[model samples]
Target: MEPDVLGLVAGALTTIAFVPQVLRILRTRSAHDISWLLFGILAVGSAMWLWYGVRVNSLPLVVTNVITLTLQLSIFGLKWRYGRGKRP
Candidate 1:
């Protein structure tokens, strides 16, 4: 397999890894157990990686991280909304 092909394969796998979690959250309509700190770090880190990908003009990095960042942010949104009242 070529390098690009390998990258795509890896990207696809990592990208899809979040799918089940996202689906579960959406299906159940709950994110009560998620940690805000963890998701915040993930979103910020992924956004930085996205910026880096854009800076270096790397297609795989840009594409993979874009999806990752979006997923992380969405999870974060759910985490925030659903996690709020549970603590009290």
Candidate 2:
């Protein structure tokens, strides 16, 4: 496989890895076990990576980070909604 193809595969895998957690949280309407701080940091980091990818003109990085950012933001929203009153 070509390098771009390999990158695309890896990007897709990493990008989609957050989907299960998102779906679980949405279905359960519970984010008590999820770490809000961690997800917050991840979202920020992913955003920065996406900006960097744009600057570097890397399609795989841009695409993957955009997807990851969206998923991470969704989790953040769930965390705020369902994890606010819960204590770890």
Candidate 3:
């Protein structure tokens, strides 16, 4: 390995890790198991990371955080739409 390759691998793993939760929520239309507050925090954090990436010109960081932000936002939307009033 190259550093760029390592970054890509890490980025892929971290970003794709959220896929299962997103898929489950989409398929089952249930986001009761996920915390909305947590997702909101994650979205904000990811946005910050994206900003950092842009400032630092780190392609891996920018790409990964962008994808993660999208996925997390999707989860937040689903939770708001379907998990409203549900506690878990």
Candidate 4:
């Protein structure tokens, strides 16, 4: 496949991969097993990717990282709210 098409497909798959987890968390209303550190690092890394994408003018990277960052931040917020209690 062409590079742009490949990038978009890859981006779409990776971007949507977080959906199930987000939906699960929302349905369960619990993020007890979620790792804050992991999500924090991911959010930061996604932000960096977004910045790099802008600098490099890669549309795939920009769009992918934007959506990824949004999802990661949402998970982060959910974790913060639902993970407040002790882990069991």
Candidate 5:
């Protein structure tokens, strides 16, 4: 298979992986179990990956990292806002 194809496949899988967590958080309006350590690492890592993707001009990497970054930031925010407080 082509390298780009592989990258796209990998990117798609990883990017979509965040969907469930995000959805659950949104649905339940709770993030009690979510940790800052996990989301923090992910946010920073995704930002770095996004930079790397831009530097290397990899479309799959750039697209997925951008999306992943957004999702991660949202989760981070949710973690801070709802992870500790009682559910509403």
Candidate 6:
């Protein structure tokens, strides 16, 4: 298999992995168990990955990191909105 193909597959899988969590949060309307630190780190990391992808000119990294960052930011926002007054 080609490297781009492999990267696309891997990126798709990892990006898709966040879907369930987002859906679950939406369904449950609860994010008390989510961690602010973790998602904060993830958001930063994803942003860095996105930047790296842009620098390297890798479509897979760019696309996937964009998506991953979006999802992570969504989760982070949800965590903040839903976790208000809740424990970590």
Name the lDDT value of residue 31 in candidate 1.
79
* TM-scores of the candidates in the order shown: 0.84, 0.88, 0.90, 0.91, 0.86, 0.91
The TM-score measured for candidate 3 stands at: 0.90
Candidate 1 global CA lDDT score: 0.82
lDDT of 6 by residue, 1-88 (tens): 9999999999999899899999999999899988888888988999999999999999999999999999998998888788766664
Tens-place lDDT per residue, model 2, 1-88, is: 9877887899998888799999999898888889877888988999999999999888888888989998998888888888776565
lDDT of 5 by residue, 1-88 (tens): 8988999899989899999999999998789888788889989999999999999999989988999999999898878877775445
Question: TM-score-based ranking, best first?
Answer: 6, 4, 3, 2, 5, 1
Which 10 consecutive positions of candidate 4 have the poorest summed lDDT? 79-88
In order, the Cα lDDT scores of the candidates are 0.82, 0.87, 0.89, 0.90, 0.89, 0.91
lDDT of 1 by residue, 4-71 (tens): 67877788898897788888888877777777788788889889988998998878888889999999
Candidate 4 residues 1-88, lDDT tens each? 9887899899999899899989999999899898888888988999999999999989999999999999999998898888766676
lDDT of 2: 0.87
**Residue 64 lDDT (model 1):** 89
**Clashes by residue pair, model 1:** none
lDDT of 5 at 56: 93
Instruction: Write candidate 3's Cα lDDT for 1-88 as tens digits.
Output: 9877888789999888899999998899887778877888989999999999999989889988989999998888888887877565
Query: Which sections of candidate 4 miss by over 4 Å?
Result: none
For model 5, the superposed segments whose C-alpha errors exceed 4 Å read 85-88
